[model samples]
Target: MSETHALDQIAAWRAAGRKTALATVVQTWGSSPRPAGSHMAINDRNEFVGSVSGGCIEGAVVEAAREVMTSGVPKTLDFGVTNEMAWEVGLACGGKVRVFVEAVE
Candidate 1:
């Protein structure tokens, strides 16, 4: 989904008093599925929108987003061929990505 649409959805959740977070692709290298500036909106309900890795690593991102929402602390997640979870998350296409996850106030 478009970034605007994702933000809109997250905004609606926030309006309903639900905790929310946004996960953004801040950096990418080599065969990345999604480029920097891509986003995903996640709420305390585990609902989400958009794509950071075109289906790769989204589960991890959502889980991290949940923690960010709870702790009110941002998290930087790195996944690549060298990371063991990269393979598990289907990021094995030989690319590296840095995602910044932050609570949405």
Candidate 2:
């Protein structure tokens, strides 16, 4: 889906008093599938929309969103294929991305 649509969903969910987390790709380098500002929204139900990487790092991001939703704390996460931890999440292209995740009221 388009980023605008995804953001609108986040706003709508927040307006409806649903627990939601917003994840944005704030930075990217080297053949990333998405550019900076790409977004994903995850609700308390664990549903997700949009994407930050080429399906490589989304699972990790969702896990982070779950934490944010539960803890009400915001986070900035960095993932790089060159890093072993990142590779565990399936990012294997030597690309890097920074994701900002926050709870949405």
Candidate 3:
């Protein structure tokens, strides 16, 4: 979904008193799938919208977002072709991505 739509969904979740997190690609090196502004909105239920690293590391971002939702602490995640999980997620593009995930207040 578009960032605007995803952000709207996050707002709706917050309105319903559901915990949520926002993950954004803060930095990237090489041929990262998504650009730095790419975003994802994740709820406490582990459901999410948007993409931070295409399909490559969105799952990881969701898991981290879930953790952030629970702990109320932000996290920075780094994934690259050198990481085995990158290969698992088909991020064979040999790029590196840095994502920041924080709880939605």
Among all candidates shown, the one with the greatest TM-score = 1
lDDT of 1 by residue, 1-105 (tens): 457888998889989999999999999999999999998999998999998996879999999998999999999999988887855775868889999999988
Name the runs in model 1 displaced over 4 angstroms: none
TM-score of each: 0.94, 0.88, 0.89
Query: Which should have the higher lDDT, number 1 or number 2?
Result: 1
> Which order, best to worst by TM-score?
1, 3, 2
Instruction: Quote model 2's TM-score.
Output: 0.88
Per-residue lDDT, model 1, residue 103, is: 96
RMSD per candidate (Å) reads 1.2, 1.6, 1.7
Instruction: State the displacement of the C-alpha of residue 3, model 3, in Å, after optimal TM-score superposition.
Output: 1.8
Give the runs in model 3 whose Cα sits over 4 Å from its true position: 87-90
lDDT of 3: 0.85
How far does residue 76 in candidate 3 sit from its true spot (Å)?
A: 0.3
For candidate 2, the lDDT comes to 0.86
lDDT, candidate 3, 9-73, per-residue tens: 89999999899999988999999889998888999888888888768788888888888888888
Model 1 global lDDT (CA atoms, 0 to 1): 0.90
